[model samples]
Target: MNQLIRTVTLLWSLALTTGDDTVTCLYSQECVLPCKSDYREIIHWQKLERQTTVNVHSFYSGTDQLKYQNEAYRGRTSMFSDQVSKGNMSLILKEVRTQDRGRYKCYTAISSANKEAFVSVKVKAPIKSVDIKMTDDGITCKTSDVYPKPKISWTINGTPKIISPKDPQEDSRGLFSLTSTLPVQPVQDSLTYTCSISSEDSTQTYIASLTEEKTEIDLGQDITIPCPGSQGETGNFTLTFGSSTVLSYNSETPQPDRIQWNGIEVKVTSKGNIILHKLDSERHAGTYTCEKLTTQSRQLIQTSVQIRTASTVGIIIAVTVSIVVAITVAVIAYVIKKRRSKTSENNGQEGSGGTGHNGTPLDDRLQSEQLVEKRSGTWTD
Candidate 1:
């Protein structure tokens, strides 16, 4: 039909005007605007907008000439000169901004023919902040002001959570504020709920937690405190007590021990929980702080740990030691008594004065008679 041909032509024109290629990137991150084909001799990048075309970058005579670059792109855009050969002419943009969204022109002046590529850049607005909490109703997630509205959803224990999202409100600055709540039902096992917010380019999340202000464990018992993750984004968790970092994950430490992440009482898990085995009163008991950090955000939670020493174990050990000592004393006394009895029996065989070595009379009647006869001469008649 003529109408169909006209619609197709209009669509083709719109595509050519908008661009064939598009690059979506997050705010405050690097973006690579790609342009395939070799333009080694000369290349020019320009931001094309309505009624204005601003110079972004230019390469000529084997050197980058930035004097014509727009001030908005100063020090934020660069092309990979080393990779310019073999039909590669990609420009790297650092810290992309929403205002930078527009069409870009990559023109290369070749001797045979001029080549060009048009690209459309789409900048994603990062979720400024994410706050999640547990309430009587259920888990609630709130977002800070975001532009163009972010994609918000919930996942419970890694499964998609069916939640009715509240209507987002628009602020005066045209930014949007969103809230998503997931009603919790009675569940037997502990459940983990994560609120994920995403833009076209990046995703960030916050997970719910059910931790007390403090945890108490008996000394020599194992304890594992959960790290519920960060509000915005987190790549790692760090556990610190006093000045010492007991354990760290995803930290840039060069030591092999740090690489393996082993501690005396503290160990970091992939789920972000810090596990302590055989809790030590001296080392493992105190205020332990857990920090989750991403490249852009950080979350911290400090929990007091009360280590209780099992005095009953000590008492049992003491009682067992006392019993052993008493038995040893009784055995020594019995051995001494037996030795004395044997010495007395040996002296009885060699009894000279009737009383043996142990002060017992060896021959009672004979000894008494002998003593009286011996004393008769000394006594007066």
Candidate 2:
């Protein structure tokens, strides 16, 4: 009896020596059974077998509590031997989920004395799959198989933005499912958008991109190429006529007349109008293209000219005849001048021959005078 009293006294002292009890457990996981302290006075710690039981209590649920038998904790809970020896009462939980997150109190009873410890469990949900939907005006993002319900947001080019909830519902899976709709004000066809969801333990991000279709205007007549004001983007632009560049603006002034056909410069006016001055049938036919230098986007406009072949042929013939007549007249005038010069030369030579060194040769002078008289009479006739 004295020895039993001494063993009981030792057990009581051991329990009292273990200061305030503390329990630790992860949220959403199976709770662990806290281990009881062993009587230090006992030489063989393992030999002194003590039957222990654990109970979980919650202040929120009145008159309701959980009792965990030793067999019930077989595969669920475990105790750290080191912590148990140091009088540290802590619970190690496993396979925790969001629903398992809450406040817990662990009670360990050995014989008639009981030790209690308090702990808070926190569980975090991991993002599973990300779903992205794209529309003409905006984008929608969703995630499933997640716990603790993540917060959703948006990002464009890595810039963060707030996303409000569009439709929210909670399913039987005890998961918060929500859809976020972002209004794409005056939607831009070239911008890329992204949606991101974040949770305490994990983060999931999805990307949805939209491309806007533009209406092409066939520039049949005069047209304006709208220039983005201060909000404009700088890029290479091409102005082409049937696969050929009529004009190109690439951050600099183009070389003038570099692209010319048939001695005419391909001209784009200051107001962005392509003017085909003196447009003839050959020059007016074919398609004109306006294109983005870096992309495959192109706008084609075609034009045609009607010409009268007969009128053109008549004008050509008239010019040819005039040239031929002028050439013929010049040739005839040259021939007449040469004949007159030869005749004058012959008359001068005969006169010189008639005039002798002695001032006259009587026969020669008589012959010359007779010849002149005969020629003058014939001419008069």
Best by TM-score: 1
Tens digits of per-residue lDDT for model 1 on 1-381? 999998876654441122469888776689999887644678889999899999999977767889989998999988887767666778899987767888899887666446678998877666766766557777777776665566677766677877666777877545577877788756534455667766434454433333224777777788876665533343666777766777666644321232222335455554446677776554567777676655444455656788767675688689999999999999999999999999998877667655545555655665787779778864333
TM-score of 1: 0.44
Q: Measure candidate 1: CA RMSD.
A: 20.2
Q: Write the per-residue lDDT of candidate 2 for residues 6-31, one digit (tens) a residue.
A: 99887764534233333333334465
Error of 2 at 371 (Å): 70
Worst 10 residues of 2 by lDDT: 40-49
Off by over 4 Å in 2: 1-94, 109-114, 157-164, 184-189, 200-381
Task: Give per-candidate clash totals.
Answer: 2, 3
When summed lDDT is taken over every stretch of 10 residues in candidate 1, the lowest stretch is: 253-262
